[model samples]
Target: MIERLLGTPYERRLLGGGRFSGPTAWLIAIMMFVMLSVAAAGLALAGSARLVSEGVARRHMAQITDGRSTGAAAVAALRAAPGVVSVTPVPEAELRRTLERWLGPSARDPDAALPIPVLIDVELAPGAAVQPVAAALKRAVPQAELISNSGRLGPMLRAVNSLAWLSAAIVALVALATASAVVLATRSALAAHRATIEVMHGIGATDEQITRLFQRKIAVDALAGGLAGALAAGIALLLISAGSLASAGEWTGGRLLGTLDLTLLALLPFIGAALATVVARRTILHSLRASL
Candidate 1:
């Protein structure tokens, strides 16, 4: 297919003599860059969702509002309960440290320390019903409030998923824009060289040949732009990854790009180039048919 799309020497001499070089290449580059960057962002959002889902699966939190004695009883009850894997009580000092992040150093001062709820982290066995566990825990310790991790983050997860979908929509819009630009450019080039096209037709140059000529030029430009854009996108993503890595312990989730993600991003430029080539060929052929 690539060989057939290559511009013949005769074809170039016959119809490729335009004064304006056009901005197809640069246009394609900008489109590719935007598309790739948006795609990477979508991938990152998806990865975060997956990590959070995995991290929270079958996890539950029990908050005892009564006292430490109630927290101890809840932990003991959870440990002896069926389908419960383990239970750990959050230390008061650790709780104070977490509060310090929001309430400042005053949270750590004993005199000014706020009332802290006793939190027990619970890990349930697979397929355990949260309702049954909550009911049992409620009966065991009335002051305990059982909260499912997934339920707590459900809204946030949905929001992340929505943003990921929006990113995909943006990428699709950019691709459609790229194709539209190619179509307009091809038509303008055809219009600019109408006399040459007529002469080529008179001299036995078929529409297929002329179409291939335009395809070759547009394909080269698109490919060059796509590559440049892809390079820029890659550097940008690398910088983002570097920044994320520099934060080290801040992001306890997974990496931005997995192996599959890397492979797909790597192919984006080639895919964009091929799409532009196809659009250009179709536009040129349709215009030629209309004109002659």
Candidate 2:
């Protein structure tokens, strides 16, 4: 049944080629380029957004130990500090285990390491002033130094947000270009098949039938293009992931990399097919009406 449908004279007429031709190849190439470009841009935006959010979430000190005073006293001072929401005292053994989990077996050797500092996990009030709070902590706890989470995270968040905006702009441009390309391609295909369409009409073919034929052809072409484009984009992302993993090495702890979710990746082909079908059908119908 599939072979009969694909091999029919009507299918050839709809496709504007003999299964393989210059116009068909060109249309496929253009659609693939557009789809891949859009996909890449979307992935970039998602990665940037994730990086920014994670940076914000992790903007706090992880460990603080007091060598001059008892660990319990240090925890008390931190808890009483203004703008601090809560402070949880983590034991030395727990701290060592956490470090070992992130830094590997070498970090677990207690003899070679300095006495692990008592970790006080601080939760600050929302909209609290960070610099003033850090200054107050420094004065209150002589053995404690302010760990500047913002120093590492602030610049990274800014960079990621900027990149996200740039990627969004690129995606918009790609979408506009794709729409224009589809419109022009459909117009050309309609012009080339003008005589065939007129003959079909003369022989009593309905407008709906002709519209369906063109829509089917456009959908098939788009599906092929979308598959090719999505494959290319996935390979590109994999290469990027591999490079990042290689570069991160031992420092890969607590780092989150953004990736395209399966759902978004799966939706691309269907979106492409729908867009192509709607655009092709609209263009053909409008042209037919003009001819009438």
Candidate 3:
């Protein structure tokens, strides 16, 4: 089926001409860039969300273990505290490394070190009152500062949620822009080849055949554009992530980094391609019918 499609005169012309057409090529290039931008933004947003969520959790856990001297004691107290499900103390060395990674080498030096606070990890009961627990921990631990993970986390989560929505909106806008570009480009291509289309129709070419020719041509163009965009976006995202990792030393002291799922990254290209193809096909079909 692929061989036959490729063998067709329309397909051959489209493959050759579409590649050479400066405007059409540019449109594809722009689409690719936009797709990549959206992907990068989405990844960043995800990273931020994870960082904020983890930070909040750690802070809250610290609140639970506030003022406790021994790790064992902190854990035990946290366990006994109302709304606490479990508690674990993060090692001081590990915490130092985490801080170093985020603050950089200069920030990690001895002179730069502040009296580091101890961090305790806590899990809350399913329906626990977070505020009450935080207040209780504040009272129980005089030297130990109580950090309500939710209090710190709520704003970050909201920001991330907003960013996610914004990314979605941007993606939708890009899709619409790509579709419009394809429609206009296809219309122009059809117009330029009007004589050819007329001759084909006059000689008994059916609408289906005409549609298929245009569809096949546009689909290939869209695919190229989508793949290019996805690749560009992926590369840009990697660069951003690398830079971020260097600066932040793994978000949320590495917990957030752990949550950066590869599966989500892998799904991006397929989604871009599918969306591009559908939009291209629809735009071409609609434009062609209107022209006819």
Candidate 4:
């Protein structure tokens, strides 16, 4: 049924290829490029956010203004606390170096008499409640200021999520635009071949035959354009990934494309072509039904 509907090699070309083919191919290519780029960005953003969120959820920080004894006691309490994984007290020298790197030479000067506090990093087991652990830490050292990463990361996570959603929206709009272009192109082809189509109908050509003639031509054009666009988008993405890898100097697991990302990207061209073919077939068939 499918083969018959699409016609065969012996079927004469009723909708002849014309000037629209080249421009239509180029237009689809551009749309595919934009769609793939936006989709890749959205995937990267979503992956990064999940990684960061997990890391933040499992970790908490404490700045202890009290003496070394208080810091040691706080670490002990956290290590023994429910849902606690591990605790590490950052060395004072390391803390001073970090401050100096960020705040300048003044932070390194012994004469400046900066009161560098004791910092303890606590890692909680998965599914731990931050508030309970924070309360336990406070009981151990009242002077210690407990900080939950979730609070600091909230706005940043929200922003990243918003951008990911925006990327999705852009991809959807590009798809809609591609479909619209295919529809208009199909309509133009139908208009251009109206007289020949009417004469075929007069000679006993059924509507299905006429529809198949247009569908086959439209499918070929769509397939050609889709493959071309996919190839161009693939090249652009490769160059982008190469530049990103060069700048990063090392592959951090989340920064590069994963298996799923590569698969989706690989399918972009076929998906675009399929979309164009489907849109064109529907538009042409509908127009034929109304006219004849």
Winning candidate number (lDDT): 1
Residue clash pairs of candidate 4? none
Listed in order, each prediction's TM-score against the native is: 0.82, 0.64, 0.66, 0.84
lDDT of 4 by residue, 174-281 (tens): 999999998887788778888988898899988877777777666666666667767777788778777774443233234545688779978988888888878877
Please give, for residues 143-236, the per-residue lDDT of candidate 1 as tens digits.
7898878888899999998999999999999999999999888788788888888888999989997887778888888888899999999898
| Best of the candidates, TM-score | 4
Model 2 misplaced stretches (Cα beyond 4 Å): 1-9, 13-38, 41-45, 48-52, 55-139, 142-148, 245-260
A best-first ranking of the candidates according to their TM-score comes to 4, 1, 3, 2
Give the alpha carbon lDDT tens digit for every residue of 62-149 in model 3. Answer: 6322232544555556677788876777766676688877777664565663555678877776567666655555555645555666
Candidate with the larger TM-score of 1 and 2: 1
Evaluate all candidate structures by whole-model CA lDDT and list the values in order: 0.83, 0.63, 0.64, 0.78
> Relative to the unseen true structure, what is the C-alpha lDDT of residue 253 in candidate 1, on a scale of 0 to 100?
55
Instruction: Please identify model 1 stretches exceeding 4 Å from their true place.
Output: 1-5, 12-22, 82-85, 96-116, 125-136, 245-252
What RMSD does model 1 have?
3.6
